[model samples]
Target: MKMKCLYVAVAAAVLSLAACRSSKDAVSVNDLDGEWNVVEIQGQAVQAESQPFIGFDAQDGRVYGYTGCNRLMGALTLSKPNKIELGQMASTLMACPDMETERLMLNALASVKSLKCSGKTLVLYGADKEPVMLLQKRFEVVPLSSLKGDWRVVSLYGAALPEGMETVPALNFDVTANRVTGNSGCNRLSGAINHDGADENSISFGNVASTRMACPDMDTENQVLSALNSVRSYGLLDNGRLALMSEGGTIVLELERSK
Candidate 1:
């Protein structure tokens, strides 16, 4: 109970000094569907590199998203038109160098009383009905849970692998352990994954180590390792495949969740 109140205080204390803005979009109350990327808090632009986002599932009566530092989730209830109330919130315990963004986000969210969402953009208002935060709609919100389990390698740099290849490289995401274990198609692959689970398609691999084994598929293994090392973010495709994107937004590695 105290922690919850602390969040409210954090938001109120930080946001009270922000210059308020009037709503300019058409009134669309309680239209908090889909995923949204936090663009601004109290008119202060969030760093472009940080991926802070939120998702609302009204039908499920829940809210979830990645804070700038950790994964956060809670309940949602809309008791009146244009009105909102967030239930107690819970989040992961990971700490980061810069937690100000997360603090601003949580503080602003806790103070949200009403909002004007125009389907593409949302402006959250505080108790004074003054805008506290701005959010832009994002396409295809990927749940962290979706990254779990085994994924079969489908393509390398968008090119399909040789047909009938016995050794198919794969990736396994163990979110709980914060580790990635899989095959480079020739060597056993293991590594650490860095993700706040918030930035739009935000994820990266680090300290990847693999067993040295001579195989005819070493070329494939090399390509896979290079791809994994270069991964910058991830995306969920309409076809239900997970795309491990590289620098400049290239789909270096494509994966399908194993059945």
Candidate 2:
């Protein structure tokens, strides 16, 4: 009778251990949602804090973010348990000194076959079941009041300004006055901006007027003016960059917070 009780106790212990292991391995799509910053690559720490990070939009099954040097977009699939698939990614081609890190990051993302999330930490595993990268939840949310500041134009229509432009375009958003004043390459522009609510995700420019000064090249000014007129919303990207989107949800301009 003692031997029989001992056997039953061992069986119960085994079942409890199995249940604990199963709970630890369980993962849901919700665990993979939200923005993540790459804190480590191949067991090495990533020192570039000003670089781009990754974000997952679970509602759309889309993943997008900056890859240190370029903007990347791809599909995310979580169809199977304990597995994930990152689809072929598309990115903007912008030359930068940190291209090596971007290349490795893109490769790691492409090779990811599984994922594990613990609290705010996320780990991606390759096909061989080895950790390829480690990411932490990015919690910095840009406030509406932070949008009122001076910004320098980084790109217009996805391209940098000419080498010998008379002056680089700049913008200054005044939250108090509900106005945006800036130099559109050749002309000084000022206009009222609409802040619908407390949500800082969307904004609109109303009736912008610019000085009639004509520079040697109106091409840049013309492009800037057109982009500004079509501006429908804006968002703060990583590294203190501002993205202005059009009515059709196209990014028309990217600006950096002026030092």
Candidate 3:
């Protein structure tokens, strides 16, 4: 009877040890999934009003986000607990006064070798196992369904109002009809948008058609049309701005929600 009790105790201890190990090794892609706003780089606080952000799309093994001034996309691979690898990244080349911060961010991303998450905070480590970047998970303020409203174009091809256009461009999405119509600053535009299989943060538009109205500002219209046609995905920024991106994850158009 004493031997039986000893055996029971040993079995219980073994089970307890296994449970502890499981808890310590528990890691999942969900831990890294979501939008994370840049808080610090190499222990220096990020001072930009438009803070950079990054997101991990576990479904497609893609990581994308804004780098203060330019949009960036890259490949991400996660191997269980605490093992992560970020592949070569591509970014847009929009000139901004805050290019210094963008450069710092891009450089840090290139050096990232692993990552650790504690609650809503994420820390990226470099080759020497030193923390290089700090980020906090960002929660969406508006639902993706809210994207069906009217939006006023704020920028096209990453630049402010094109040279001669005095009027602002606009885009309107009719979610129920799966159709979109708008003014491309110099022409009337309409198109079919497909959100059928899109997630809350991504969408694609069909071929957009515009009325051929010759205006002195055809330059702006052409830029707008090109941007709209190339849009392959969309994301809403923390400040309520809407970004339309191409397949390569470059921000082609930016807009603001209009009442």
TM-score on alpha carbons, each prediction: 0.49, 0.53, 0.67
Instruction: List the candidate 2 regions with Cα displacement exceeding 4 Å.
Output: 1-55, 64-111, 116-123, 131-140, 194-200, 229-252, 256-259
Q: Mind giving the per-residue lDDT tens digits that candidate 3 earns over 1-259?
A: 9998986675445434211123233335656676788999999999984658898876589899988788899999875456778889998889998888898998999999877776667888999999999998654434446778799998877677855457689999888888889998878999888763536556677878989878878778888888887887777766678878777556688899886
For model 1, residues 209-229, the per-residue Cα lDDT tens digits are 999989887778899999999
Which 10-residue window in model 3 sums to the lowest lDDT?
17-26
- What's the CA RMSD of model 3 in angstroms? 8.4
Per-model CA lDDT versus the true structure = 0.77, 0.77, 0.77
The TM-score of predicted model 1 comes to 0.49
The worst-scoring run of ten residues by lDDT in candidate 2 lies at 14-23
Residue 13's lDDT within candidate 1 is 59
Which tens-of-lDDT digit does each residue in 1-259 have in candidate 2? 9998986675445434211133255455556665677888888788663445788765588988777678889998866556788899999899987787888888889999988777667888999999999987654345557779899888887688888776889999998888999999889999988866754456788889999986987998889889988887776665568878675345588898888
Q: Candidate 1 regions off by >4 Å?
A: 1-31, 140-259
Task: Select the stronger candidate by TM-score from 1 and 2.
Answer: 2
- The TM-score, computed over Cα atoms with residue i paired to residue i, of candidate 3 is 0.67
